[model samples]
Target: MASYLAQEVQLARRHDEILSQRSVLLQQMETHLGDKKTEKTLQMLAADAAYKRNTALLNDIEAAEKRLQAGVHLQPHPNIVKIETLYWASVEESIPKWEQFLLGRAQTPVGFKKKKSSEYNISHAKVAAQR
Candidate 1:
């Protein structure tokens, strides 16, 4: 409850900060436009947009807080969960394909064979020494 209130306060402060910054920007825009009528129109539009965005965010937070306070446990839909699980599982299954696409080559499989140190010949040793 306290956390929600703190979050709400923080959000309000941020919204006000954004509006203050935008007000300065709008003043600069008004100077650039040089038409009182157009400047007023633009200012109104900007303010309306900002108000909508801020109100929407505040409403969402308020709703969430209210729901939390109500203490009503809600269960997720099984179908939705099942679908998401399958989707993620498919994504996990296709990771190798994604790696191949991104890398422009096949990914080395697990437990790939490697030459034993004993398999290195004198020529190989000489090449390594040259490097």
Candidate 2:
């Protein structure tokens, strides 16, 4: 988790650098405002995209921090001792279930109560039981 947080911090720094460059480009484009409206528009659009990308990175960092906090609260001093072939192979399949569990959806043994359906009033207990 410390490594993950460090990587995210590095990524945020990179995004900040890119955002700085975008700001500079926007400023240069502002100087040419009277000439070539199309070019100025394109530059603005590019800056906007960069801003959106940075915003997304901020959101990802926030989510990662939240997950880290939740994990620490739930499992202190967690360690990975070994990984068998079967468990390693099924990691891709299990990740989504674990994500759902983290997001408050019920899981086998760990979470017994099923979440209520948001779109429809119908109870999906039968469907969940099948899983």
Residue pairs in clash, model 2: none
TM-score of each: 0.28, 0.32
Q: Please, what are the lDDT tens digits per residue for candidate 2 over residues 1-131?
A: 99999999999999999999999999888877756787788899999999999999999999999999998877333244234545776876677768776778756535455555763344465567778
Candidate 2 deviant stretches above 4 angstroms: 1-35, 76-131
RMSD list, candidates in order: 29.1, 33.1
Kindly provide the TM-score of model 2 when superposed on the true structure, using C-alpha atoms.
Answer: 0.32
Error of 1 at 29 (Å): 18
Candidate 1 per-residue lDDT, tens place, 1-131, comes to: 99999999999999999999999999998887778778799999999999999999999999999999776576668998899999999989978756775687875555556566767676598899999
After TM-score superposition, the amount by which residue 96's alpha carbon in candidate 2 deviates from its true location, in angstroms, is 50
Evaluate model 1: give its lDDT: 0.86
lDDT of 1 at 31: 82
